[model samples]
Target: MMRGEGQELLNDVGCICEENGALDLLQVVVGKGDVYDGIWTELQKDHASLQAEIGYLLQNQQKFDVNLNVRHFGKVTKSTIQADGTLMDAAEKIFRGTIDFVRGSADSVGAETEQVLLLGDDVVNKTIPVILCAEENVQGSHGAAIGELDEETLFYFGARGMDRTQAENTIARAKLEAKIQKIGDADIEQKVKTQLAEVLDRDNR
Candidate 1:
């Protein structure tokens, strides 16, 4: 987890998986600041696998950039998920990801997905997803979603006595909550939820 308060942050991460091994990672960031996050992962042997998920919520005049690189050295599986939300026109974000299937990485499978929610028009969002394959039997896929809330959805929340901002906050919270609920430790999960609620309340204020 990472948080920033009007300062710049840079997070660089690397991971390697050996033969028949697996790796899983989750990263979350929230606040009003500038952030640049980069991750590089390699599957070094047959049957190795890697899974990584990243979530971020930025409000006010914040900027975020994320980059991910995955290399399949052998037959392996790699998957990545990126979920991001921006609540103000001054926020900006960019996501860049790449998956490379090397020559010996036959039968390797890789997938990447990114979802972004925009609450205002002046927010800047850029996404670049790439898959490069040198093996004949490799499979790679990527997809992304970037948009604002629909009027119908807003109306549904309004009917429940929630204003437009409240509805948008609820939707954004759901994205992070989905991941938080997956924590294996109940105590940690609850603690995170509480902290998240406090943060959301502060932001709303």
Candidate 2:
């Protein structure tokens, strides 16, 4: 219905839109270069009743990428990818509502998004490889964090019993475990657990 920002919109590649509703965007960011590389396949039958809302908060240096695919019948297909890579090449997405046919992956198919966050003199690097897809009858949502400890959360943990290092380790391990459980893949889950344990042990050393 209404599109703003006068931003250069890419096509048939990184992120594409083929829908009927107005893409109400507010200060979205995207990476530069040949970022688009796929033809999104969406069904066109259930139109008129599609809605989406997106919000992104990012901080980084490298490039960021996003791809979306949405379909509806008897109406039009809609796909959107909005982001702000202001601080860093941060990747984010928000999907709320239903779909007739769903396909494709967001969070970079075969690329790795790495970021290094610094606190005082301590430096830690984080790399996140995310591939998310969902089939919803009504509504669905997805989110990710591919970085080190949060200052506030770490402070809370330290205030309780852990030192800075111990708190970071504990929080990192817990985050990994939660991510593994969300995936629900046993093999990968065990691998993540082992890696988290190693990281935690190293923190003590």
Candidate 3:
């Protein structure tokens, strides 16, 4: 949690998967209030795999900077990184994801993807996805989807008698539902959901 105004928040993570080892990781970050967070994973032996997922929500001029790095140093290694984020009302966000395949890491596979939702004209979003390889037999890919809601999708809600404000609120809630479920504690999740509702309601006015 952020301590106070003008303070910074940062979290760094590192993991090593041994031979025949596997790891599945999930990360969630919410800022309202730099939140710099980084994760690094290394696969050092045969048949090692890593799966990483990250979710973030920022609003009200908040700022968040995050990065993920996955390194493959063994044969038949695999890694996948997925990131989902939402930014609203002058908020700023930057995300960088890299997958490195070292020599001798033949047959290794890696993919990274990012999805972002923009809800304000003043919001700023930047994403950099990189794949570095030193192995000819390895496979790697990266993709990003970032933008506001499409008109057709928004129309789907208007047809149901919802106004433009209502439509945006509904769409944002639907997207946030998935991340809300990622919250482990029931009480905390509910609290955040309630806070989100209040925020949206204020905007609706």
Candidate 4:
């Protein structure tokens, strides 16, 4: 977890997977802040694998940049998920992800996905997902989706008597809530929800 307020926050992570080992990592960031995050993973033996997930919510003039690098030295698997949301003008984000399948990593599989939601026109979002293969039997894939709120969805909220700003806030909260819900700790989830409500209310003011 990280927070930024008119300043830059940087994070670097490294992981090594031994024979028959598996690693799972999750990173989450929130608020109107600037952030840079980088993660590197290396698979050292057969059957070693890694999974990583990152989530970000940026509002106001916040900015975030993320990089993920994975190298498969043996038969292994790598999977990554990145989700980001931007709610106001001047917010920007960039994501760069790469997976390398080496010669001995035959039969290895790598997959990556990135999703970004935008709520204002003045916000900027960019994503670059890459997979490099040095083995013929390896498989790699990546996908990305970026968009803003659709009119029909907003209209449905409007019919329920919620204004545009209210509806947008709801959507933004939902995006971050989805990530928090994955924590697998009921007590922690409730605590985070309480903090989130305070943050959201402050932002509205």
Q: Return the TM-score for each candidate structure.
A: 0.89, 0.33, 0.87, 0.90
Write down the lDDT of every candidate, Cα atoms only. Answer: 0.78, 0.34, 0.81, 0.77
Residue-pair clashes per prediction, in order, are 0, 16, 0, 0
Relative to the unseen true structure, what is the Cα RMSD of model 1? 2.1
Comparing 2 with 3 on TM-score, the higher-scoring candidate is 3
Residues 13-74, candidate 4: write the lDDT tens digits.
99888888887877667754688888888987888888787776676677788888989888
lDDT of 1 by residue, 1-205 (tens): 5454668888998888889888787776665468999989899889988788877777666788888888999775555555555445457888888889989998889888888888887888888898998898988888888788999999899999999878977988898888777667898777777766755674453
Question: What's the CA error at residue 114 for candidate 4, in Å?
Answer: 1.2
What TM-score does candidate 1 reach?
Answer: 0.89
Query: How does model 4 fare in lDDT?
Result: 0.77
Error of 1 at 176 (Å): 1.0
Question: Tens-digit lDDT track for model 3 on 27-90?
Answer: 6655344588888899999999998887766777778888888999999999988888778778
Candidate 4 segments whose C-alpha is farther than 4 A from its true place: 186-191, 202-205
Top candidate on lDDT is: 3
After aligning candidate 4 to the native by TM-score, how far in Å is the CA of 139 from where it should be?
1.1
Q: 1-205 in candidate 2: lDDT tens per residue?
A: 1111232334342223333433332222222221221223343333322222222222222222334444433333333332211122232222222223344322211111222222222322222223334433322233333345577878898789888766745544443344346445687556655544542463322
lDDT of 2: 0.34
